[model samples]
Target chain A: MAVNTIHREPPEQSAYRGVRRVDHSPQIFNNQPARYYLMWLLLPAVLLLAAISLYPFVWLIYMSLHEVQLAPGKSDLWAGVDNFTRLFSDKSFARGWVTLFKYSALCLSVEISLGVLVAVILNNSRLEKLFITIFLMPMMMAPVVAGFLYMFLYNGTFGWYFWLLRSLGVLDGGTILGNKSWAMAGIVATDVWQWTPLIALITLAGLKRVPQEQLEANMVDGAGPLRNFFSVALPNLYPFLLIAILLRFMDNFRFIDTILIMTGGGPANATKILPTYLFDVSFKFFELGRGAAIAFTLLLLTILLGLILTKIFEDPTRKIKTDGMD
Target chain B: MTSVTIKDVWKYYGKTMAVKELNIEVRDNEFLCLLGPSGCGKSSTLRMLAGLEFISSGEVFFGDLKVNDIPPRDRDIAMVFENYALYPHKTVFENMANPLKLQRMNKTDIKERVVWAAQMLEIEELLQRKPVELSGGQKQRTAIGRAIVREPKVFLFDEPIAHLDAKLRSHMRGELKHLQRRLETTTVYVTHDQLEGMTMADRIAVMHEGVLQQLGTPGEIYNHPVNEFVAGFVGEPPMNFLDCRIEGAGDSASLVYDNMNLALGGEQSRILETKGAAREVRLGIRPDDLTIEMGTDHGLELSAKIFVTEPLGGDMLIEADFGQDRMTIKRKIAELGQPGDACGIAVNSEKLHVFDRDTGEAFF
Candidate 1:
C-alpha cells in the first residue's frame, strides 16, 4: 500500500484565513473590565508605599540642604554645599571611609568563601531542601537582634565566651568589645553571620542553572570531580558570585544599624563605618548638612560599586567563554 | 571496527524498568537500527551502549572486552544526539575536533581529520561558523561530522534527523545512508520512524514496551511479521486485520466474517483446508492486496458505502463502512468513487495472512 496515500485540503490555509478574519467579537477587544480590575488591585499598594516610603526620600534630600530648628513654628535655612564641605574636612568622615572599606572587605570575603563552600556542600546533599531551609534561618533573623545577641555572647566576664577564652588563654582583656582591635572584628563577624546565608542562597540558585547534561558529559569525557568544579562549576557560577559580592558589598556598607545596636561606633570610634558615622553626625551631633553630604556621598559610592559589579558580574559573554572551551 | 554486543542487558530507574533483557549483536561495520515507538526503550538501549547511562544488570561487550564498567571515553564510541548537542559557542571545526583533541592527537592530525569529515558531509565551507548560525540540517551534518572525526570503534545515533522538516528528513535520509556506507563503523542508530529503519538499516530491531518484537531485515519484517504488533507497525496504511472464522472443507474451505465470505484459493486455500474450521483467526491483508469493485467475485464479496475518498497524487484511499466496522481500500487515483457510493471488495487470496486469534501469531 506504499503507493496509496491519502490527502486532504491542507489545514494551514483554513487556519490562516480564520485568524485573518475578524468577527467583531466582543471577547477580543472588550477588556475594560480587566483593566479596571487590575487598576483596583494595584492602586492601594501603590498609594500606600508612595506615601510612607518614597515621600520621605524626597523630604530627606530637601531637608539635607536646609537646617531644621527645634523651636516650634521656626523656618529652616538653606546652606547649599556648606554641609558637604564640612563633611570633607571632618577626620571622622575619613575614618568612616577606612572603617567602611575594612568592614566591607572582611564581610564580603568571609561571606563569599563560606557561602560558596556551603552552597557546594548543600547542592549535592540528599536533604538539599531541608539543609537550605535550616541554613537560611540566620539570614531570616533581624540583623539588629542578631548583632545584640552576638554582643552578649562576646561579653568579657559574665559571658560564656570570655570564660571560655580565659580558659583557652586567649582572653586577658576585660572585654573583646572594649578593645579597638577587636571592635571591627566583632562588627564584621556580626554582619557575616547574618548575611552569609544570602550569598549561599544566590550561589545555590546559580548552581541549579548549570546543566546536568553538561556535567554528565564531562564525566563521560573522563574529567573528574575536581577538574569539573574548577573548569565547569566555578566558571559557570561567575555571574552568581559577582552578584553575591555586589550585594554583600552594598549591604556591608549600609551595615550601620547592626553595628550601632552592637557597639554604638565602639570604643575610640574603631568600628565607625560610614552609616554609623553618618548617624552620629546627623542625629547624635545634629550636623545635618555634613550628615546629608556624607549620606549622599555614601549613596554615590553604593551606585558606583553597584555599576562596576554589575558590569563585571553580568558579562553576557560568560557562557560563551566557559562553554566556548574546546 | 569492532563488534558491539549487548548481553541480556536490563536497565531500571528505581522500580520502573526502562529496558528489559535486551540482547543484540552488532557485527563489524553493520548499520543496525533500534526501531520502535516512543517509550519503547530504543534510545535507552542506545544510550546504554554509548556508556552515557548505567546498566542495571548484564554486561555489554566492545569487541571481546566486557565494557560494563568502562567509561564512555575509553569505550571509543561517538554519539549524535537528537537535539544535535553541538557546542554552540565553538566553531564547527572546534566542535568536530574535540574528541580528537581529548585523545591528544597532534594539531595537524586534528585539522586533517576535521577537514576530511567536513568535506565528506559537504560542510567544509561552514567549518568556522558556530552552531547557532547554521540551519537545522547543517547543524545535524556538523554533529555527524563531529562523531565521524573521532573514528571510534562504534557509532551511536539517537534520532539524529528527527528535528528536520519532512522534506529535509527525506533528503538527509539519503545523505545518512551514503555516509554510513562510506564510514561503515558498526553503527547503532535509534529512531521511532519505521521508514527510517526500513530505508537504512541492514537489520531492524523492532521493539514495543521495552520488549523486542522482531529482529530481521526490513523485507522479512514486512512480509513475515512475527505477531500482530509487528504486522500492524511495519507498513504504511498498516496491514489490516479482519476477524474471521474458517468454514467448509478441502478446496471449498473458506474464511467467513460478518456479511462476507472469503474464497481462499491457491496456497492460502490449501493452508486453510488442512487447518479446519475449528478456530477463529484474524485475517491480515495489506491494502494493496484488496481490490475495490462494483460486483461479486470468486472472492469475499462485501458491500460497503464509501465514507470518504482521498485522491492522493498517484493513488487514492477509500474509507468505507463494512457493516458496523470501518475499513480502507487503496486504489488508483483515477477512480470516480465518491462518498456514499456503494461498492464491493475482492480479496487477493494469494496474499492472505491467517493469524491465530488468541496469540495473534501468524498461522501460515
Candidate 2:
C-alpha cells in the first residue's frame, strides 16, 4: 500500500533530481492522478481485515434490530427500534452510563495527575533507570491478576489496606469492595494502581523529548527550574498527555475484567458501569439483542470522542508547526 | 555593558575535559567571537560564560563579582542558541516578551519593547506567528529579537545563524554585527565559520582541541597567526603548508623543496637569522597570497603542475601540486588551466609564513 504513494520513476530522474531531497509526494502521470497498483495487490489482506472488523459491526447492527435466537434452528423475531427505544426508559442503562463516566473520570484524573508527577520526579533522578523499571512493573501485571491481588488487600477479614484504613479512621471498618460508598473508589484504585504507570511511561518518553535547548534558553531568560517546567516542559507534554488520556478512555470502554472480578457490579448494582452492565445483559440474562444495542451506543460514543479529540489535535493553537513533516 | 573575564576556567564532563584552563576577557561593549570547529570547546566556553555550564575549577568574573556559582537566571545574560530555541507553543511576540515578563515588567512596557524589537528585526508581521510557521530566517530573527528585547548586560550567541541557508546566513551576519554595535552590549558569539568571526567580531579568539590558540583582531589572526592551527582554521580554503628546509648561511635564507626554492623576504630572513640556525620548517601561505598562471614563468621560483581548476563565477581556485603538497591559488578567472597542465606559482614575498616543522609554531 505504501509503495503506491512513491514516485515510480528512478529517483535521480525524478523532481528532486539535483538537490538530493527525497521527494515522497505521490506520483502523477501526465498531469493526472497515478493509479494505486499496490492497493490492488493488498486486496486480499484488505478483504480479510474487512471480514474481521466489518462483519462483526454489521452483525451487531443486525442483532440490535431483532430478538436474536439463542438456540440453534430457532428463528429470530424482528424488533423495530424497540431495543433502542427501551433503553431510554430503563433506569439501569442510564445509571450505567453515568457510572461509567464517573468511573472513567475518577480513574483518569488520578492517573494523569499522579502519573505525570511521578514522571517529572523520575525523569532526571539519580535512580531514573532503576525507578522506571520498578514503576512499570504494575503495568506488566494482568488486569485480572491485579484485581485478585487488590481483592485480597481490600478484604475485610485480613486485608492490610483495610486494616490501615480502619486504623486511620477513614474506612469505619467497611470493606472497600463491599460498601456502596467505597466500591467506586475500590475499582478506581485498582485501575489507577494497574494503569497509572502506563501514563507515566508515555509522559516520561515525552519528557525525554522536551527540547534541551528550549529548557536552557528558558533558564537564560530568567525562569527558575519550577517555572521552566510550567512554561516549557508542560506545554511540550500536552500532546503526549492527550494521547495517554484518549488511550485510557478507549481502554475504559472495553476493560471490565477487574470490575467483574472485584465487584461483579457490586452488592446492589452500585458499581455497575456500562461495560459491566452490558456483560450482565449479554451473558447473564442472554439478552443478546439488548446487549448489542448497548454495545453499539458505547462504540458510537467512543468514535464521537475520538473525532472530538482529533479535532482538538488538529487545532492550530495546540499543534507545534514543523517543517517537511508530511 | 560590562567586561566579562573568564580566568583559568576548565570544564570537565565526567572524566573528559571540554575546556582546559581557558582565559579570555571580553571588553566592555565589545564583541568577542569564540571561533573553532566542532568539539573545539568554543560552545562550552560560551556556555560557561552564560552560567549555563559549571566551570570546573576557575573564576568567571562579570565585572567584579565572580559569577561561577550563579545560575543563568541571575546572570542577566541572554543567549541565542544554535537551533534558535523559541518556545514552540508561544507566538513570536510572546517569546520575545518572556524575559521582560519574567522581570515582572508592566504589560504596556513589555508590548512596546517587543514591538520595538520586532521593528528593528523587520519581523513585525511575524510576531503573531509561532516559531513553526516562520521560515528558518524568520525563526533566527525571532531568536535574536528575544535576546535584544531584554537589553541584558551580555548577549551570548551560539552559532545563531548556523542553520540558515547560505544567502540568509551572510545577510544575518551583517545584521547581527550591526545590531550588536547599536546595542553596545558585551557579546560573546561562538561559530565554527571563520567568515563569521572575521566579519563580525572585534576580536576573534581561535580555539582548537580545548586550548586557546590565539586571541587577536581578525587581521592579526589572519596575517600573523601564533601557530599553524590558527592560520589553517581561520581562513577560507585554508592556508596551505609546504615542507621545506631552511638552507641559507647568513641573512639570505631560502626555503628549499623539490621543484621549489623560494627566497624569504628581507624582514622575515632577518627575523629567522635572529631566532636560530638553519633548520627544516613548514612554509604557510593563504590561497589568496599565492599566484597561479598558465604555462611556465622562469622568474617565479616555484613551478608545479595544475591539479584542478574550479571557477566560482567571478573568481577561480586552482589547485596546484608542489611536489607532495597541493596548494590552492585564488584569483580572478581571466586565466584558465586544465588538469595536469604545468603552471608557475609566485609567492607574495612579505605574506610568507615559516613555521617550526616539529612544533608547528610560527617562525615569522
Candidate 3:
C-alpha cells in the first residue's frame, strides 16, 4: 500500500460544549406542504373549544353593550356603555366589590389557620383517619343544605348554636344571620364549615410530600419538632398552601349558594358579594345588560388574580426547587 | 469533642432485628467507620448514636452522658445523610447556618462560622445557591459543610459519599479524613464500601447480617482478619478459600487437599498445633500471595488450568480451576498464555490464613 500520513487537529473539548443562548424560532413542521394538512387535522378540536368558550364570551360582550329584551318578538335596544358607565356611581356596585373582598378575606384567614392547624394535628395523630373522615363530612354535604343547616343553628329563636354562643358570652346579643355586623361572619362561617376540610386535605397531602430526609436533617441540625416544621416542613408546604388559597379564593367568588341561602344579602347588605349582586341583577330583576357588564369586570378580575397566582408560582426565590434532582 | 460509646446496642423495627449487640467505643478525635453491606445494621447503629432511632436495648453515651432518651436535637450531634439531604429551599449559607441559628447564636457569629465552613469545603461561591442548583459533588460538599459548621460533640455520617461518583468519592475520602482530623471531633461514619473503610477509618467495625464480624484497624483487619467473612470482605480482589485437611502436627503438619499434600510453614504449623481442634479447616489466602509460574514443574502448589485471564494495564488477573474451586492469581508480568493453558502456582505459605470450616473463625 502507498504510504499516506495526514493529521487533522481535533476540536478542543470546550469548543463544542453546546452552551449557547436559545432564541425563539418556530420549527413545528419541517414539511411545509404537510403543515397545512396537520393544521386541517387540528381545526376540529380548535373550533369545538372556541364554540364552548369563545362564543359564549363574545356573546357576553355583545350583550353587555345592548339592553337585552326578553319580550317575544321585541327588538333589543343598543345602549353603548351606559350599563357599564352606570356602575361607577352605583352604591351597591362598589359595595359589592368591597364586600366580596371582605368575605373572601374572612373565609381565607379562618380556613387557612384552622385548616393548617387541623392538618398538623391530624398528621401525627393515631385517630387521623377517623377525624379526617368526620371533617370531610361537611365538605360532602350540598352547599345549600349546609347553609340551611347552619341557618337553623344560627336562628336566635330556637337555634342551638345561638343559645350556646349567648351562654358562652361570645355572641353577646346579635343573632348570627339576622344582625348586620355578624351576618357576613355568619355566611363566612358557613363557607368555612363547607370548605375548610378541602384546605386541610390539600395541606395533609403537602405534609406527606415534604421530604422526610429534610425533616430528619433539620432535627440532626439541632431543630426541635416545632422548629423543624417551621424550618423545613413549612417551606416545603408553601406551594401547596398557595394552591389551596387560590382554590378557596376562586371558590369564594363562584359559590354563593350557601351565602344566598343563609343570608340573602340581608342585614343591610353586609354579605352582598359581587356574585350575589350579579345573581340578583341577572336573575331576580332580569337586568341582563347590567349583569353582563358586571360579569365582564368580574371575569377580568379573576383572570388578573390567576395571573398573579401564576407569577407567585413562578417566583424563583421562594420556590422549593428540587426539580430533576429527585 | 467527645468519645462516643455504644454499649450492647440493639435495634429492632417490629420483629426485624436491624442491629444486634453492636458495641463500639469511638475515642475523641478518632474516625471510626462502620463497614457493612446494605441492611447490615451499620446505618441503624449510626442513627442510634445520633438519637434518630430508638435503641431496643442497651445504651449509647457521648462521653459520660447517657443519650438513650435524648432527642436528636438535644443530643448535640450532627449527621450527614446518604442522600445529602440539603434543605432544597434554603441557600447553602442558610443550610449551614441553621444549626447555629437553632443554638440562638448571634448573627455575626453564625455568619462567621458558616463562612469558615464554606471556605473549608470550597463551597464559598455556592453559598448563595439553593440545593437544587448544586451539582451532586457540590451538594455533598454543602452537606459536609453543614455537618462541620455545627462543630458538634460527635459527628455521625451515614454513607454520606455513597451517592457521589467514583472520582468524587475517592477525592472526598481524603477531604473528609483531613476535615475530621482538623476538627478533632469524634466521628462515627457508616459505609458499605470496604475501600472507604480501609482508607479513611482510624478503626473499622465490620458488620455482616446485623452481627459484628470484626473490629480492628486497617492493618490488623487486612493482615489478621478474625474470621473468613472479614478476610473475604476487607480486600479489593478479595481472599480465596479452599476446603482442606490439616494432617499430623508441628513439623509434619500439612494441608491435604485434592492430589497435593502441602506442608505448613513453621509459624503456621505452630499456630495450627495450638489452635486447630478438628483436622478439617478452610485454607484462606489472598490472590496477591499466589504467584503464577508458567510452564514449570518445581514448587507447584497443585496444578490448574487457566479458566480466564484479565490483563489490566498495570497488573493481570488469572483465574484457574484448582480441583473443584476456582483460584484467582494477580501478577504484574504478562509472560502468560491464553485461557486453558496449564500453569503451576507457588504459594507463599506464611501469608496463608486458615479458618474453621464449621464456624468460619480464623485459626491464626
Candidate 4:
C-alpha cells in the first residue's frame, strides 16, 4: 500500500474575528435519568402524608367558625363566633378549663418526679435493662387497653387493687372512682402510673449519652455527688427534661380514650377534662360547633405549650452565649 | 511535682491478665512515656495510675503516700484524653476554670488561673467560645489548659495529640514537650507512636503483650534494644531480620545464607565462635545502615530485583525481591535505581545485629 501525502498553504487568520459559536450546552444531567426519576417519586408520599394529617387541622379551624348541628347527616350553619361566645359564658366549660389546668399541674409534677427518680436508680445500677423493661411495660400498652385494665383493677368489689388498698388503710370501704372528690386524684394517679415510664426512659437515654469523659473530668475536679449532679448532670439533662415536659403536656390533653372510658366524664363532671368535654358537647349534647371550637382552643393551648418548650430547648446556650465570657 | 513508683503492679480482667507485674519509677520532674501498640496494657497502666483502674496486686506510691486505694479526685492528678474531653456546654474559660472552681476557690483566683492558662496556651482569644465552636487543635489546647491550671502533682496524658493532623501533631508534640519542661511536673505519657515517645519522653518504657520489654532513654532504646521486639518496634522503618546459619570453624566464624556468606565483625568474632557450627541465627540490619550498590563490599552482597520504589522526599524506600522473599531498603531517592533493575545490597558490617534464631534474643 502506497502512503498518501498532501501539502497545502495555510489560510491567514483574521486579527479580531467574531464568530457565532454554537453553545453546545453541557449535559448537566449526565447520569442516568432513572436516578432522578426515583427521587421525584418520594415527593408524592410526603405530600400525601401532609395532606392527610394537615388537611384535618385546616378543616378543624374552618369548623370552629361555623355552628354545627349533628343529627345524622345534617349540614352545619355559619354562626360565626357564636359558639365561642357561648363557651365563655358557660360554667361547665369554665369548670372544664379549671379542671384541665389542675390535672395537668398534678400529672406533670408527679410524672416528672417519679420519672427522674426511676431514671437515677436505673442509671446507677447493673439491673438497668431489666428495670427499664419492667417500667416501660405500662407505657407500651395502648391507651384504650390501659384504661380498661385500670378500670378492672380499680373496680370496687371485684378489683384486687381496691381490696389491697382497703386492707392497707389507704382507701375507705366504698369505691373511690365513683366519688367526685377523689375522681381527679384517681385520673392523675393513672396518668402517673402509665406515663412516668416514658419520662424515665428519655432521661435514662440522656444520662447514657452524657459524656463519660465529662463525668470523669468532673470527678477529677473534686466535685462531690451533689455538686456534680447540680452543676454538670442537671445542666446536661435540661434538654431531655424539656422534651419530657412537652410530651407529657401533649399526652395530658389527649387523655380522652382513657379518661372517657374509665370515668365516663365522671360523677357530676368532676374529672371532665378538655377532650372529654369536647366529646360530651359534640356527641352527647349534639353541639358540634361548640365542640369543634373547644377542640381548636385545646389545639392552640397545646401549640403554645410546644412553643414554650421549643424556646427552652432551642437556646441551651442562650444565657451563656449572651453573657459572652462573664 | 511528685515522684511515682509502681511496684510489682498487676491488673486482671476477670481471669485474663491485662498487665503483668509492671514495675517502673517516674522520677520527680521526669517525663516518662509508656510506648506500645494497642491492647499492650499501656492505657491500663496509665488508668491505674490515675486511679481509674484498680490494681489487682501491688502498690502504687505518689511521693511517700501509697495511692492504691485513693480515689481519683483525691489523688490530685490531671489528665488529658485523646478526644480533648472538654465540656461542650461550657465556655473555654469555664472549661479551664472548672478544676479550680471545684476546689471552691475564690472567684478572682479562678479567673486569674484560667486567664493565666489560656494566655500560656495562646488561647486567650478563645475564652468566650464553646468547645463545640473550637477547632480540634483549639479544643485540645483548652483541655491541656484545663489540666495545667489544676497544677496537680502529676499529669497523665493519654495520647492527647493522636487525633490531630500530621503537621499539627508535630507542632503540638513540641508544644507538649516544652510545656512539660516548663512545668517540671512528673508526667506519664502514653502513646503507640514511637516518634512521639522518642521526641517527647525523657525515658520510654517499651511494652509488648502486657509485659515491660525495656525501659531506658530513647537513644539507648534505639541504639541498644534489648530484644527482637524492642529492636523492631523503636525505629521508623523497622529493622529487618534475616534467618541465617553459622558455619566454618575456629576464629574464622562466618554467617552463611542461601546464596551468600557474611564474615562476622571483629566484636562478634568471639560470640560467633562460641555459637558453634550449623547454629541458626537471625541477622538484623536497619534500613538506614544497609548500603546499596552494583558491587560487593567486605560484607555479603545479595542481588535483588527492584519491584517498587517509593520516593519519600530525601529518602526512597525500595521493595525488592531476593528469589521468592521480599525486603524493603531505604536509600537516597536521587541515586535510586528504577523498578526491574538489578542492584546489589550490602549490610554495613559494624551495624549487623545477630540474634538466636529460635529464641530471637540479640547475641551481640
Q: Report the number of the highest-DockQ candidate.
A: 2
iRMS per model in Å: 9.5, 12.8, 13.8, 20.5
Better of 1 and 2 by TM-score: 2
Docking class of 2: acceptable
Candidate 3, residues A67-95: lDDT per residue as tens digits?
A: 99999998889999999999999999999
Task: Please identify model 1 stretches exceeding 4 Å from their true place.
Answer: A1-54, A67-74, A158-186, A229-246, A267-270, A315-326, B86-101, B104-135, B248-253, B263-278, B294-300
Give the worst 10-residue stretch by lDDT in candidate 1 chain B: B293-302
User: How many Å off is the CA of B80 in candidate 4?
Assistant: 0.3
Best by the lDDT measure: 2
Q: lDDT per residue, candidate 3, B1-364, as tens digits?
A: 9998889988899999998887888988899999988899998898888878888999998999999999988988888999988888788898899899989999999999998887777677778788777788888888888888877998889999898878778877877887888889999999989999999999999999889988889999999999999999989798989999988897679888876687787878887778754799998989999978776463586888889998887899999887778998988966866788888876778889999999999987
Which runs of model 2 end up more than 4 angstroms from their true locations?
A1-36, A313-326
Residue-by-residue lDDT tens digits, candidate 4, B64-174: 999999988899999998788787778899889989988889999999888888778878888998877777888898999999997999999999989887877887887
Ranking by lDDT: 2, 3, 4, 1
Which is superior by TM-score, 2 or 3? 2
What lDDT would candidate 1 get against the real structure?
0.79
DockQ, every prediction: 0.15, 0.31, 0.28, 0.20
Stretches off by above 4 angstroms in model 3 are A1-45, A172-174, A313-326, B294-299
How does each model score on lDDT?
0.79, 0.88, 0.87, 0.83
Number of the top candidate by TM-score?
2
- Residue A142 accuracy (lDDT) in model 3: 93
Candidate 1 collision pairs: none
A198-295 per-residue lDDT for model 1 (tens digits): 89999999999776654544444445577657655775688889888987888787767788887898789888887998998888988665677778
When summed lDDT is taken over every stretch of 10 residues in candidate 4 chain B, the lowest stretch is: B292-301
